[model samples]
Target: MAYTDDEILAGLAEIINEETGLETDAVQLDKTFTDDLDIDSLSMMTIAVTAEEKFGVKIPDEEVKNLVTVNDAVTYIKNAQS
Candidate 1:
């Protein structure tokens, strides 16, 4: 299956909300996970694991560091689905 960037972003926002109690709208493309969302390392791991399961993508541990913003994660998952 494939997903659009908007779908990926919405899915990611839901995951982040579930993991952090943040509002879905608060998750924007340019928002940094750490600096903007205040997501700590532990929450990031949980989000990554959940996102992998939800999106059916293998987000390797090393690659997680590269996903700095919501756009980054959405783009990664969108590409992985291809």
Candidate 2:
């Protein structure tokens, strides 16, 4: 069930949009979830949980912090799938 980066990005963007009401196009590779997107910790946690379920990957609590940017999360999930 591996996904290309574009597919992952689109799916992640959709998740972010659903959780935060953000436009899917606003989610870019370099956008920081907190600084750029203004995502609070609670939203981040929710996004992490949702992403885990959607991507079928276990994103540990501690590792969530390391996922600072959209690209960071995309890369982590891509690697986790492998």
Candidate 3:
């Protein structure tokens, strides 16, 4: 089954928070993962892993690099789930 935007957002928050040791409530929709949340490559990779496992989806490498913001990850998750 596909996830809703809210569900995607929730999953992203959980994954990102867990990977970066940040609070989900601290993330903003427009915040850049790198600049704002301080999520590095390794952490992002972990986020990807978590997202893939949680949603049962594959995110392409090219698309992954382009994702800089929380919304970007949520959008990717939503599309992947669909």
Q: Give the TM-scores of the predictions, in the order they appear.
A: 0.97, 0.96, 0.90
Q: Supply the TM-score for candidate 2.
A: 0.96
The deviation in Å at residue 1 for candidate 1 is 1.1
Question: Best to worst by lDDT, what's the order?
Answer: 1, 2, 3
Off by over 4 Å in 1: none
The digit string of per-residue lDDT tens for model 3 on 14-37 reads: 877777778988776899988989
Best by lDDT: 1
Q: Global lDDT of each model?
A: 0.94, 0.93, 0.83
Please, what are the lDDT tens digits per residue for candidate 2 over residues 1-82? 9988999999999999998899999999999999999999889999999988888999999999899999999999999996
Per-residue C-alpha lDDT of model 1 across residues 1-82, encoded as one tens digit per residue: 8988999999999999999999999999999999999999889999999999999999999999999999999999998985
Q: Which parts of model 3 are misplaced by more than 4 Å?
A: none
**Which model, 1 or 2, shows the larger lDDT?**
1
Q: Is candidate 1 or candidate 3 better by TM-score?
A: 1
